[model samples]
Target: MKIAVMGAGAVGCYYGAMLARAGHSVTLVGRPQLVTAVQAHRLILEAAGRTEAVPVDATTDPSGVAGADAVLFCVKANDTLTAGRVIASHLGSSVPVLSLQNGVDSAEHLQAVLGRPVVPAAVYVAVDMPAPAHVRHHGRGELVIGPGPSSADIAEVFSRAGIPTEVSENVKGVLWAKLIVNCAYNALSAVAQLPYGQMMKTDSVPETMRDIVAECLAVAERSNVMVPGEVMSTVLGLAASMPDQLSSTAQDLAQGKESEIDHLNGYIVRAAARLGIAAPVNRALLVMVRLVEAKAQSARR
Candidate 1:
């Protein structure tokens, strides 16, 4: 299989390396820094206390996807449509593109831009890039993608590459569940500049999270998405399971990068409004994160 990873961030590098290690020809397209490092050495993947220099091709041009059999679209939510357009002319007309990103609408949005069907994938992993072309995996790495004509084959290939994968008929609900988790934690963590453990210890944090979860559930209900199981318990248990982990939003802020708050809590707020339901808690969190982002951007300026 020839795989093209559209983003060379942590998620892309980690999965691309796994496929390369499985003997698939993989190419990563991204920024110049990642391209330079990857072209010089292999993709340095650090996981489970071992480092593997996985061989793969790298390029800064989107045209690197020209002959790919499949593409892993891993850009940030805001870049979905733009990235889709950038790669559309380079991709095969019938190639399967998998969106392994956060937020519920990325796949749909990208599909619209490229005028093709895109598989939506819910990614469960803790990954980071300590340096360009170097990916570090901290914990679980599994994927649940929507059931489609090509889903089974994709899942099989991913599984063979040492990635746990499932083809789920309820991918919408799964994505909504992950979105709910992001909504409940990301903004608060970023605003406080705290990890899961310390963030939960702050005053009124639990109550705030409860309010956010309630609003998100209400929004999900309005969207007719059945988020199965004990959602509240799962949201509450995240801190205990990953005490020191910082939300991606927090990490983004710390790095002076644009956070994905608009796609997380802000999406909930807008969706709820469209359905005539108010998500005040989520709206507040969205604003708070935006304020922090503004401050960060201003400092950079």
Candidate 2:
């Protein structure tokens, strides 16, 4: 399959490298720095104490997506509309685009912009870019892609590439489940600059997470999305499962990059407002993250 990965951040590079290694022709469209690094040394993928350079095409131009059979839209949630606009003219109407992003609304948002079908995918992986063109995988690399005309075939390709993929009719629910987890921890982790283990250990952290999850669950119920799993259990288990791992938002904040708070807790806040529901806990977290981001910006000046 001819694959194009838009964004080429840690998530993009990790999955793109996997597909490339599985012999799919993959082109990564990203920033010049990453494009240059990938062009020079392929993509360095580090996983399970092993590192391998996976060769794939890399470009800084959105036009790189033109001939792709499928495109993976992996940009941060806040970049969805901007990146969608950049690639809209270049993408074929028939090409299947998958939003392999954190937020639940990205695929729908991108689809609205592109006027084309887009599959929502729940990306289950812990990855980070330690350097340009390099992706370090902590663990778990799988995806649950929403049902679409091309979902089965895409899932097959990804599974063949050792990505552990599944095509799901309930991907939205899965996404909401994941979103709830993010709402519970991402802001707290970012505000504290702590990994999940330490963040969970802090006083009142568990209680706060529970409150966030409760608000998200209420919002999800009103939205008619059945968020799977016991929310509190999942929220608490993440810390044990990825003890030393920082929330992606925390990592982004630490790098002075914009965190996706607007999509996580902020999404819940908006949804609650629309449904005439109260989400004070979620709103508080969203506001706190925004304040932190604002403070970070001021520090830069």
Task: State each model's CA lDDT, in order.
Answer: 0.90, 0.90
253 Cα displacement, candidate 2 (Å): 0.8
On a 0 to 1 TM-score scale, where does candidate 1 land against the true structure? Answer: 0.96
Q: Pick the candidate with the highest TM-score.
A: 2
Q: Count the backbone clashes (under 3 Å) in each candidate.
A: 0, 0
For every model shown, what is its TM-score relative to the native structure?
0.96, 0.97
Q: In model 2, which runs have C-alpha deviations exceeding 4 angstroms?
A: none
lDDT tens readout by residue for model 2, 86-182: 9999988789999999888899999999998899999878888889999999878989999988889888888989999998788999999999988
Off by more than 4 A, model 1: none
Considering only N, C-alpha and C atoms within 3 Å, which residue pairs clash in candidate 2?
none
